[model samples]
Target: MRKRKTPDFLAQAHDPADPNPWLALYLDRSTPLPDEVKKSWLTDSSSNSRQYLLPLLRPIARGFIILIQVLKIFLPRKWSHSRLLHRVLAWGLTRFVSPEANWLILRHFHLGAQILAFIAANSPVPITTTPLEPRNIDDLKDDLFVKHDLNLFNFVIRLNQALRDAGVEMHPPARVDFSMIRDPGLRLEDMPHTRLNFLDLQSAIELFTPLYQLMLTDNDFWRAANSLQLDETIGIYAARLMGAPEHLILVNNKHPLVPMSTLRAGYRLVLHGLSTEMLHSLLMDRKAAQEQPPAEI
Candidate 1:
């Protein structure tokens, strides 16, 4: 009999496969900053974007900002200088200087930074990252159908089958979103916009956390984490039956853009955020049946 594989969380990266597969995005030469601005900014550790955009108003903003000492004693830290100053500066920059702030910078510079800046300038910036991230269900499909040979839906079906053979059955009433991939931008079709404006995608990813984790388990995540640490992986995997390799193999898919290892980890992390009850509902019916009802004797 083949020895069963158990997950080892710490062993996978650098030595083997790191599931995040940051290599693609990390090593990409493309940067969000414009070519001219990228060169000037990357070289300067202390490049003050405001220094260039609002030189005349900097001194006045500085004085207004110092008033933060008084605000600190009365307001939340979020409203303090470190965070609030940027907005105060932006307000002072745009209002006292630019009058109209540049949308291009506001979108690309990072939302929190821009948000504080907008608040400082007392302006409102439109949020653009939503409607761009793939839904949790779509994310699975993107992994299986777009990135790999088996469609994610089919891949999940296989996982359910493997579990059934082990005398474990996933529950009823599954929902899926299989919309034709739409680019939030005009430039890309179905592809995640090469120019997704959010400086950090985590905020967007958080929205689906509950649904993401409804399908995964702590053990599943630990295994996926291990897979990332090990280069032995071709893709990512999570199973309702923690001990089932067949189920694990079914859920994780291998593809060029999203390696099996990376997507597996991504999906697992998304699941990590889901309510454990969601996973238990699908995986625990037999266990639930065997349990005796609360007895009062």
Candidate 2:
């Protein structure tokens, strides 16, 4: 039997030179994110990005949303929850999704879990459920992402820090365990070594369309994986109660349009696919760090 090679995600995780800046927000925040980067993520915009295309894509997104809505009327309400559907999605993800992409997707759930738990713990009003499992994201079935949303991970971190400054004790999420990602259930090792170097927005839309549609039908798997939208009402309410600064408090205030929301979500989702210039920068930074000579003792 041929020797099994280490997966890109495993190597990337263990690499001493962390390439992705966003990871710092959750994994290590000793270094603050730059203002421009922070602004860009807040608005989901950057100089070289394709947000300009949303105008053209909106009508198409509206049409697709309508079609999915119509199709749902005819299909089994829970058809998206089929175990086989998830299996097929998992197979494609492991084989075609880049290591960085997979890493982001898996990490998002962990981060989201932490934020939800933190919010639940400190909310002025009581939360009925404390969501620890990533799957518990299905609890967000009533919420939705809108245009120009704040990155939830960023928002939570800022809120936590703000609350601490105001003399409130905070409940931080459990430390992330990268090793758990190698579990057989996740199948991260199955990814090919020669995965694509770029992740485009269209590719993300194509990849997530079926899952997104299924999510709309209230499928647990995709809803948990893709539709983890934070409730603006709850988030804002909590932020105000906790005395977080107006600057630190943020939410998806844009009106919901399923098609446009999906496209906007797809735009953000492409980052999970590691297709953005920032992701490329991370990979390049890691490579450069690896190639540098060891420092003398």
TM-score versus the correct structure, for each prediction = 0.18, 0.44
Candidate 2 residue-wise lDDT at 136: 24
Residue-level lDDT of model 2, residues 1-297, one tens digit each, is 123232222123544565643333334533233233333232222212124544454456646656776677888776644444445545554455444344444434443444444455554333433222333213223232311122443454455566666766443224311221211132333323343322323443555554556553544423332332434433443344344334122333322123134434554454332222232233234335646799999
Model 2: CA > 4 A from native:
1-66, 76-78, 124-193, 196-202, 214-231, 247-265, 268-297
Q: Pick the candidate with the highest lDDT.
A: 2
In the predicted model 2, the residue pairs found to clash are 199-275
The lDDT per prediction is: 0.27, 0.39
- Backbone collisions counted per model: 22, 1
RMSD each, Å? 22.9, 12.7
Q: Across residues 167-230, which tens digit of lDDT does each residue of candidate 1 receive?
A: 6433221321112111122111121222212221222222222222222233332233443232
